[model samples]
Target: TDKPAHARTSNLNEELGQVDTILSDKTGTLTCNSMEFIKCSVGGTAYGRGITEVERALARRKESTLPQKLGADYARLSGEKTFVKGFNFKDERIMDGNWVNEPRANVIQKFLQLLAICHTALPEIDEETGNISYEAESPDEAAFVIAAREFGFEFYERTQTSISLREFDPTSAKKVERSYQLLDVLEFNSTRKRMSVIVRDAKGKLLLLCKGADRLVNLNIMSAHAYNSDLFSLLPRHFISCPFSLEMKSAAIKAFKTSVAQQITDAKALLTSSSETPETLALIIDGKSLTYALEDDVKDLFLELAIGCASVICCRSSPKQKAQVTQMVKVKTGSTTLAVGDGANDVGMIQEADIGIGISGVEGMQAVMSSDIAIAQFRYLERLLLVHGHWCYRRISSMICYFFYKNIVFGFTLFFFEMYASFSGQAVYNDWFLSLYNVFFTSLPVIALGVFDQDVSSRYCLKFSLLYQEGVQNVLFSWVRIFGWVFNGLLSSVIIFFFCVGAMDHQAFRNSGEVVGLEILGATMYTCVVWVVNCQMALSISYFTYIQHLFIWGSIVLWYLFLMAYGAINPTISTTAFQVFIEACAPAPSFWMLTLLALGTSLLPYFVFASIQMRFFPMYHQMIQWIKADGQSNDPEYCQVVRQRSLRHTTVGYTARFEASKHFEEFSEIKSH
Candidate 1:
């Protein structure tokens, strides 16, 4: 199979098939990090009805409708808007229009003002066109500044002590100038979801402006309550239950019910209210709350709120917290975890995960260096995990099983031959032939199988992501299956040895003189071992392509050639011995008859087992378990049946969950339907 263009590492490819949980960073990885201020919240109302360039393009193609649905404000911002490259502000409601006549114009003005004053973006004006751009540490900060510029509050200059903005004043119906002394900037970080700036206006009024994800604000409120240990202790137990529990206890429990209901009502009121707090307020939270939420006592409550709330965002989370969260999910669920990001901050979580994916994006190469796999974009992760991941897991597992089987069959044949010789410890075949058997004859076929064999097509793998759960659940490779292969190898060895010995010991070889008889017996037994080992290609379920077939059959041809060469080169025996060996190894009627008998005796048991499995047990996995007696206890048949039923039920449940995964839907167009 061809590797995807985005993938960087093949070393951990198989890990993709086993991922049960994915922890992803929001910026750069999920959002492209090329921020465009497409929308904003003002006076408890979201304004600015536009989406980003990528979103618009995706929407236009109908490849993804999610971005379009997300831009629900599109209708309001659709008319007569000024166009900006890379920023899709095509709505007239919030672009280039005089703010004097707009509804809630005061709130809109304050919102624009907030965007302009935010930290870290510095303006750069083109000498020829007079168009302004921003230079900032974070793209998101630049986006906010750009949005403010397009909305008529242009942040044009900043110095060590002050900031200046050109604004459209509604009262005067004219552009006005404003300057503020820079008081302080509270920068954004993982733990602090929001950033705040304190500025002294021309009038010397000290004002603090803040913005961030809503979840951050909600967590802050919880943290404030948690800070007061007395108040938190008074609250009912049901609200802050176990970390894993999502269910809320009965409302009949008055203390818990009242507290939760009141908090919900207060949150709703704050979100719905039109008035700005002190000036114009956007409902938001800060990182202090997140820090508090991470503590043992309050972590469960935080998780409850975080999971239950649909639009909550954890702002300003520290990289340590990110890794901790991933580790927590892995420990709680006992599932494989995958973490993806593109920045240095993301390295911790990426390393903590079972499989880490890093985007080689604008953030830097730190994350990519730490990750198991690297990709150009987050979207490519779909094909990487679904198609390539499945192929690697299946191929590698089958290769290992077959490797063990081949070695056991060859090794145990020697063991049986030793027993036949009454433990004299003499070699059955030449040392050179025995050494070359695995390296030259058997190696290429299994290598080809591991690299090229596919039980299901890439299309099918993508369509049924539920199949990936097999790797995570360890359905194919287990102790039982390994032991089962060993048992089969032993059985085949017994059949091959007995059949070959029986034929060689008959009157034909015995009637010859002692020396010639021993030589013929050795040659006949060696042929039986070679033929039995080669017959494994027939029983294997791996897909055999042109290369695989060439290698498998080519090995048999090479073995025959080696035998002819060995007869001519050996100095220990005379010409007559060589002639006798040739006669025994010839493709004569009796030689072929003995070969067929050996093959049939060695393979018949497996053929019958395979037929029964195919006919009665259509499920390949169940057939494997039945062969191995997996999951059975030292109990009655009824108990074993009950255990098997339970196992089946669990598998069905995991399959259903995997089929319904949102990540699968996001990547697989076929599964989406």
Candidate 2:
């Protein structure tokens, strides 16, 4: 949890803000990445009395619906919070060597023995403590070894040709040390979807111990060697198809390539086929079926069916299949997609996504290395995307638009001045003013905007996550917004130029009674430009801090200080700017009056436009801030109310896609059971 989030790429901030669909791996990205053997079915009997998190959730949903029944359920679940890592089995039928009294004790022994003698986990023994720790390629394998040990089949040592275990013999009621001759290991790979280990027991009987995904782990294949062969035949298939399949003996399966293609044609024919309302149907595909479904001819159909369904499950899928699904979703919808993972198997999918987030967890560093962003925990994504991401998008957009506005304001005034002088090339500002305008006067304010400006607080950004839709909609940095800024700059330039020229035309200075020359005119105009642009910056900032205040106000003060200091120097060095501010401009009342007049006039249009937009047609974030100010943000139904009123909710969009696809494994774990 101490692992800090790292942004690997510069431009990914804006992309993170706009992610619409997230395709994530299950093992480590959404999980704790530490595996525990919670439940297992063997010999036609399910062991482990602990209820899964999914069952607790379903129970909570029922309690919430029927409050009168809540107390009874709450009392039943009270004070049952004991948790252990790697081993969570709690059935009294098997715990503390109680499996000896069971009807099929011999079968359980073989299962436990298989767990202890499995492939490819090295044992590290602490000589001082006499405790053994395992280092396996995966958490699942390690969990199996640990669970076996907890059940009194301790796998204490392993070598190239033998696996030694300390076991409790139920018949003798004593602990026995046993060694099995390891023959060969058929390692697990993506293609096989299972791993097997061959070992010769003390009686010289060859045994093949296997484990894998449900689709490939058929107990019937090993029933001939099982002590309780009749019990194995009576076991439940556990191949669940749908909600109502408990009464059905066999599910009517659909071939992936053919059914998907046909369904796409059928879906196109119906008027409401793509409607987003709950349809209660789920699409499930396996690795072998996905192979045919992923061909160019069937890919589009597969995507269409997958998207149209209420949910999708990809079971026994290979690494390539994960990447293919992510790529298909990204390409077909044309929406921004994010992939998250925490293992080497997920690297391809992570890299294929538009935004890749890797979790630094028990899985390893392969995903973290290839990711666009690295986070410590999955929950941190809430802050990453909602708060930091929104801030980044808004800051970049505002900085870019401000650059356009200031450049136009400064350059356009000079363009008008050149036109007013009949193309004589008489500059509107002094050489030093021109040289230092951007570098000194206007630089700090823009830097503050780019680095620290935020439209809303981080807490508020997270509180109202719907505010993120604005960035996804490209509300801040669009062509229309860019053109609007250009227009504002053009208007400011016009007001600053003409107002200065018209007010000072043939006007006399009160102190000296001398007509203002080109130098005096240029100096006054430069003062107006600085005031107008900096005032605009002050108005643009939504949340102001001391840094912004210093930059904005200090820049104006810096301008005046540089002018007086440079003017006080010798006339030869100061040249045209010599005493321009001190003797001519600063001493005259007209300069002050005209400067204030031009500044106010230049900023007047912007003020009106902003007021009108805020008052009449507010954006998503503006409305959210307004609600927060009105004290509605604390209400439980606040997000729902906001969603109902949002313009983005008019059509079913990427938000739904994200909910459906993102963490589907976690969802399936909750609902599929």
Candidate 3:
């Protein structure tokens, strides 16, 4: 509640702490989803060196020769440059219309034209500024349109059936108007990895322009060796319903497979020549291939290949496939799963996982509504899980155990008092006092502990991510630990009863032969129970702030005040009982001795056990494990390996893997945008 992150359900917070695997969406969730025209491939040549926006700004500053607060380096080239909207490059050969004179000028022009007319992005002009902007279904399409505009092929207008573009015609050395009559559009879907448009140009030539994720096309080649010409023939039969000629489609498929194979061969050669491990590369697959890989015949082989690969990119994947992958991981590894996304397409995956985090972004609210936790951005997940998640699990687990312990001690003490009265069912304490003990006397301190008590700071949580393993391994709320707490409660109850009975002048009270003697005994038992429960505040691992201290210690002060008032004013307590309570509670040698002895009896043994366990046998996670080990595994050398392996299977492992992927930078960019 004190932090920016909000949890709709308290129980879900514990699940976040236990997340071992995070299945995240690529766009909007991992990458900035807001596409920047960073690099491009045209005429088999890559252009626009992959540099970020900050690097471009630095490059611009370095090239400037103005006299300023910071001096420019003369070693860097200085020039008057014509800046493109999305393209930022310092190479003179590719800048300021210089690419128009290159040998592949026609190919560049055709590439820009293809980018302009290939999708369903609609252009809008600002009435006031007269500036044109595009509305696109996806960031990739929007980036293409923006790139086309920057390359001198401005998509100015579109109707139901035609697209108009104003272009700089290098052959004519002037700007020219061109219209493409759109014959048909093949829009992208999960099944169709690419989108294409059939448009008739001004010259009456109809051409198909297409773009898609290259990973989807290139990855299938790795498995081509598993089948022969018969399988290739079957692929064409599967696409028989398509309008294209069978021969044309078959030739295109064959060419594409051949090109992909060559690409893999070249890549492997480059890696080998440089003495790099090819295993570090990711395995890429599309939805179609993923489905095939999951078939019983190839499932084992697919799992081996997927797991051994350093990374995987499942391109053009459907929502159902995403959910299937999430389920597969959970069943196989027996690990907690977390899925995060920002769109309706992710709803299935989000609902399928143990913990789902939704980012409220450009996508609709469907994912957010379905998720366990809704966040404003993906990056906030790191803090929400590590800090708040850890605290919530620790607090609730401790609160539950303490709740049980407190009630058990109070109940057992009454049972012990019942023996003194010949197994009578009568309660030792007053009905009102017994009713208020849990609700009024003890509630606030535990509530405060649950809400505000934090064993570690937020900074430490982020630094030592392995601490999150506590929840995953069920270290706090296990059966063994719960029973250990129950044992402590029973021990405390026995100590309180025997100590109070031995210290009291029972014979003197019995000589009076009044019901007031029974009342006096009840008061002594009540005070002992209160003292023992309150002592838990001192033993808790959580750091107590000033308010927490006031909540705990102030409750003890209030209890004493209530006892004094109850003895004096309550009709149930006679004059003799009042005098006995006052004598026992007052500042005197016997009172002090009795009070100190009761407190020490109830608290000392438990405190000693806790200190020994934490200081010397910390690796013994549970009392049961320690007992079973017979003191043989107390040393770090005996248990460190198993503990480290357990730690690596938890949230710490996920965080380490995430950092290695460099996905954090993408999350930062999306948040900044």
Candidate 4:
């Protein structure tokens, strides 16, 4: 909660509510913006305390054949109280020099040594506590270094030409300090997809250590196909339980020297040769492949396949590619898209989206500066979209509809009166009342409703995330709903005018013992209009706060007070309204009866319609409210029950897309939901 949601536009809530798709950056946008060394594989053997999704699937597959469990059966060492902050590995075979007993101990030592010295991270030592903390350009580098330190290969110092490390020597079974003469440090980039360091050990042994995307790392040592197959086997078996039937394809271009035109042709061929059901294809391609995939000739086909899949992973993409993907989804799907990011690279995509959510993270403020909405973390996006967004859309829509209804109710009364008066242009309300109708009498209450109205509690909104579909469907502000309100307003105008004129036509004022004249008739009709419209506002409000009550009731009181004050003025200035309320309208029995009659008659139809709708054919929001009032919303299975009862109206292909950011130094994936 340290970071609150910040909005740039007043209508951002409405936009957020209608968002059918979201395109987000991975690193600081989806993750906790931090990294931990969770699992690792070496020499075809997995070493980690955690039972990962991959291991769980393997365990299930080998359950019948194997006598013991697959993952948890592997012994894990207990963590000490003073454990490394970023290191989480706990496999007994790899902790506390135990790797010396393994057959591949020499290879494991090389791997651990490589992890310790391979990054652009600088260690920050606290002066008082003397604890080492790494300040790195990326989370992955810091994670690797910390994991290496926890594995008994501590990189203690670094100089311009050499690096020092305190490592475990299996020969003497002791920690030995050593330094390696540095040769060169090759930094990583989007194109190379890898970073490597060369060094000369004490025995004049020159060695190279590199880490990067699978394609690049495997290219130097083994055939890409064999390396990829082995690496793929170590991945989590996510496709086994996928909801959609996806034909996963990996188009990591084998050569980079191909011309743009040829690359475009290749990409088009890949798209065309895809499963006939391109809708079920999940593409895993590198940046170079994406270059041709996004070319004008192939973009359409690429979008067709990408938009349909649950995920399209574009590994090692640049900022331009991210923006291109966002624009493609927006233009092709014609759906509202929200882009989220936390770095400079994401600025383009964030600005290109319908709504941009920038995360204030370790990366920087460029994304936040360009965003329409700024938030601290990705988790808050749920409340921002589902709760606040729904509330704003509901409020604005109702306020607009009410505006139409009240204006019609007030304006059309004069139209009806003109017909009765034979087109004489006789005014139905006082001049002051007409002048102040929108400014005072009907303004504040609607403002209150517009700013504060909420149909359901925020908790209920979050609990039933599906309720947000109402806004996406434009249920509240639909053309049909608008016209229905207009028709209701017209109907109310008829009842107020005809009933007022008819009742007053043959009636006599009790105080004066005379038939009601034009002045009294006009004043009485004005009274009905004010009460009816204000009372309509009261009925429309669902969640009433003290401010709402003040505005609604205060509006009515202010109108009466204005009348009495204006009546007290001299007839020269007040004109028609001079003493009208005091002598002619206030004490007249027929005026009071007609005012009450018109008010009740005008509201009765609306009340009945609303009651019937709420009782028999309630909308989704109404049902949610009813459940909340009945205390059924707290049930954990409430959403399932609603689904089973056919309350949900499902719509598919409403995507929420996300990309990977720079600081992650990990794979970037584009997922659609």
Candidate 5:
């Protein structure tokens, strides 16, 4: 009976929430996984917000209270708030910096056609279903074509006779009749990283424009023109170094190579038209690099500012960089973490997380099956902390404190009586009665507390308070409360013991027995024994709000009622160990008031613990105190804000997720065997 009750709790995730550090992935985790080509910069004039732009515009409708959303390329686009100084996007007309070009209005039609007709994957449309399935190897390539259709531009069909051909000129030209010419085509290869085509007009005039890896494209044009390689210089570093890849990393590499092989063909004597022998030009296209150049230019400020910009590190990155970015967050922050992802690339980072939550209804099947806690709504993220995360910590700590208080009352009397029986020939209560009370009352309430656990998110969210760690301090004092209870019970029991002994004249009932006392005094000792056994049963309800609040209170009550109605208040149990029977009536009325005062004194520990918490942990205590506050009060709005803000950070840590995921992985490891 002196042993403490066992604790039942959610895995210790709440502790992790107290940690100050948190790491997160960038791709899909920070940046949306869906990438779109909304803007392309030429000269200094920039275009498009990209797909992220469209999303921000849409999200603004929901969060209109916040500052206006800004574009990522705003540094180069906005002329007024520009940070580029002399380096503007559109300053000296089309070739100058400091302006934004409306690509959506002008050559967008041609741009769509180029992305679609020149691309490999054909959009699958169901005639009977009227459903169009646009399957592409790469999401970026697929996104471009979708935007094209969304804008009412279709990839147009072209015929050989419709347009005349022209050769490469120094400047780029839009898609037009003169755009197609019997010009040389530089094949696109994955290894080469670019694609190009040249054309010559009737007058033998040449023009060229190429799109591919910025470095390779610039190199080839400069090689042909014998122009300064400055434009081709550092092209990869500045324009293409941003990591990417959502899925199909290796397939993308293969697709890059296959597309190039399709373009190679021989040329005839006139060297014009697809009908002419394409053998010479096609032969060595796979490994060809028409021109090459290298340069080093670093963005000194960008690297420093990148600390705040949420840039991702993508070591061994795929076409998508989400996992690599997640890895970077772990190394940098060094804290237990939770990652929510729904993609194959997320698998590496998901497994790496302290809590990995894979969304079932979004993206891929692999991620859903990999997560620890799969919920329908990501917004539950807030509630999860409120209930199962940090709030769980608060509750567990409170319960432990409550148990300590109960321990005090238990220890003083249980030990005192046990010691008395062993040393002084005084066994007050029958051991059988003591065992019955322990079984019925002591454990039921604690077990019920564990079984009926519920979510508490709606109840609390607290900001960091001056008394943030009051829960821990309260736990230490709670033990003191329990001791106070035990001391009071011991004091009460001792009074009864001595009073019965002094008043009685001993009369031995058996040759081996020395009784509690002789005659009526012995009768008083018997009454005291019955009262103390029942007191222990009643006191178990201390932590509960009311008797009914305890899950097993009814069961404890039934046991007590059974004892009062049928059990004889005697030490001997030959035939009446549990059979309720009335003892002979008392010689005098019981001193009920004395027992009440003594029991109440034992509850002094509860008053002390509450007072300390009320004084020191005023924020939380005040919250409990204001449980009666109504909305009609003058401070309704202010109180609501205070309450809501309090819960924002008070989450039970993701400890359950960490442990569950760990065990799951270990289980899977064994199963894989």
Candidate 6:
């Protein structure tokens, strides 16, 4: 708790306040979290279709009809990478492994099957609970493998270490590679933007097969197709003499058999959930024994695929990308960046952030275990920030408004009654009414109103110290407007009731009157009730433009019901006849009229609120623009003055911490300026 999530690394702390640039990962962080393996390139040929990082490959059979024919290598690449492999038709480039095409899975559907009967990643059964659970290395990889099983592909048992399909790599002996040794499988990271596999292929050649963002790839299929379109134009025509390039563009494709596994080897599952933790796969590939390397044409084709690609869509992304990007955002913004992810891959980023909130519902315990704050829902973000944390500030501010007005109005009434009662032998309601009214009806309603206040825009303004300005005046005005609408029609009943009670002295004799002080008392109690309810209603309504949310309506009814029950059974009901008369007043429609009057009075605040929305609410986006356009409109000077005071207060608690650190002098210097 002493250090921020991302501050575990010392270098990041030094770069604070200097974040003038921003860099982010395209997947999961900026974009929704999804990764698939689609598209592939063999020799120089590219294949597969679709935008997601996850895809299915069921079309490239050795016995299919297309631009070219499928050979053993192309079929093997398809089975492993989950992309359709092989060539079609009389076209030499397509069959000769001289060209690649990203064919849509639906391009040929009969062959597409997700056979689930026999598979490496099978559902595990529990005896006691009859529960089902299975394990997969990566969430995305698991999805494709499951999808293949679901469609119709049965798990063929022909594996000593690995598995492949028939008509592709027949004879398990021929299907296996000698030089390429499978190294450790590392998960993708949001920060790194890459996932690599180490392999030692034929002739003892070691190479790192990296598949991530297509932009990082070396070849594209579109470029080559466009390059040889005329060659493809002739039917039964084939271009068998295209060269492969080492430099490539857009590594959007992975080549293997058209099958998948839960995990490549028998290892304890580490990064199963979708997280931001830095996941890396370690593989060893030997290049010395390699016979076929991508030529220039193949490289150009990959580059074309990388450029102009809308979404990284479907590439096996690495775990490091997730963690790295979160750090990048913090560094670039020069501020704390909170990243909430629910995957094992999200761990590094979670540890690397100033604050890391993890969602723990489904992704699993690893993600939740690494998170600082775990929430049950995504919508709770607004609730956490707006309704709970900042509600305290809003409640205090609104209370200050209510307090100001109540004291002023009550003080005037008390002073007036003191003089009149001394002179005329009577006053309005006693001090008990003044104190009891707010405590009972006003307090709960107002507090209840506050309990429900939350908004998208309100939180932003409140965060920046823009809620109020210049202390007393700001406090004074918030209530002026609040009570102005609150008391416009209210003053009439108060004046009449004050006079009638003083003249006739209704409190002196109880049975002489029933509706004696009814107008004033009812208006006073319910006006305060409805106005605060309106404030609650208004606060609720202001956000969604509809005041009838279940919470708003329920809070209103719940508090009123509680008060009604209290009035029915309270000891005060039997204390005095005057009290009993007031309490015994039927649930009449009269005060409700007064409530309408109070609601009507609130119309005056509409324009003021509109001005706040148009002026105060949007002050951040165009604070300077509003000033240049008309600071007089929202009073930019007061805004700036309020801004300075509030900012200093927020940082005050951290002062000692800053003081103990070497950064204090620099912070103080900036503050002084």
**Local accuracy of candidate 4 as per-residue lDDT tens digits, 281-318:** 33556677789999999999887666544444555677
Instruction: Provide the RMSD of all predictions against the true structure, rounded to 1 decimal.
Output: 12.9, 9.6, 13.5, 9.3, 18.7, 18.1
Per-residue lDDT of 100-145 in model 5, one digit per residue for the tens?
2444323433343344333333466678986444565444545545
Report lDDT (CA) for all predictions: 0.61, 0.73, 0.63, 0.71, 0.38, 0.36
Clashing pairs in 2: none
Q: For candidate 3, what is the TM-score?
A: 0.75
Once fitted onto the true fold, the runs of candidate 1 whose alpha carbons sit more than 4 angstroms away are: 1-11, 34-36, 44-79, 85-94, 102-107, 158-162, 176-183, 198-207, 213-316, 331-334, 506-518, 572-583, 620-673
lDDT of 6: 0.36
TM-score computed on alpha carbons, candidate 4 = 0.81
lDDT score, candidate 4, position 45 = 68
Of 2 and 6, the candidate ranking higher by lDDT: 2
Tens-place lDDT digits, model 3, residues 184-298: 9999876666788999998999887776656554532111111111111111221221111100000010112323333332222211222333223345666678789877788
Query: Could you give candidate 1's per-residue lDDT for residues 332-439 as a string of tens digits?
Result: 556666887888988988898878888887777898889878877666766676678777887777778888888888888788889988989977666666778789
Off by over 4 Å in 4: 53-76, 79-82, 159-162, 169-177, 180-184, 198-208, 221-289, 306-316, 422-426, 506-518, 629-651, 654-673
- Count of backbone collisions in candidate 3: 0
**Winning model by TM-score:** 2
Q: At residue 387, what lDDT does model 6 achieve?
A: 29
- lDDT value, residue 50 of candidate 6: 26
What are the TM-scores, per candidate, against the unseen true structure?
A: 0.72, 0.84, 0.75, 0.81, 0.50, 0.38
- Better candidate by TM-score, 1 or 5: 1
Tell me the spans in candidate 6 whose CA falls farther than 4 Å from its real position. 1-35, 43-45, 49-135, 139-338, 345-439, 447-673
Which of the predicted structures, 2 or 5, would earn the higher TM-score when compared with the native? 2
The list of candidate 3 runs beyond 4 A from truth reads 1-6, 52-86, 89-100, 215-286, 295-313, 331-334, 505-516, 569-592, 619-673
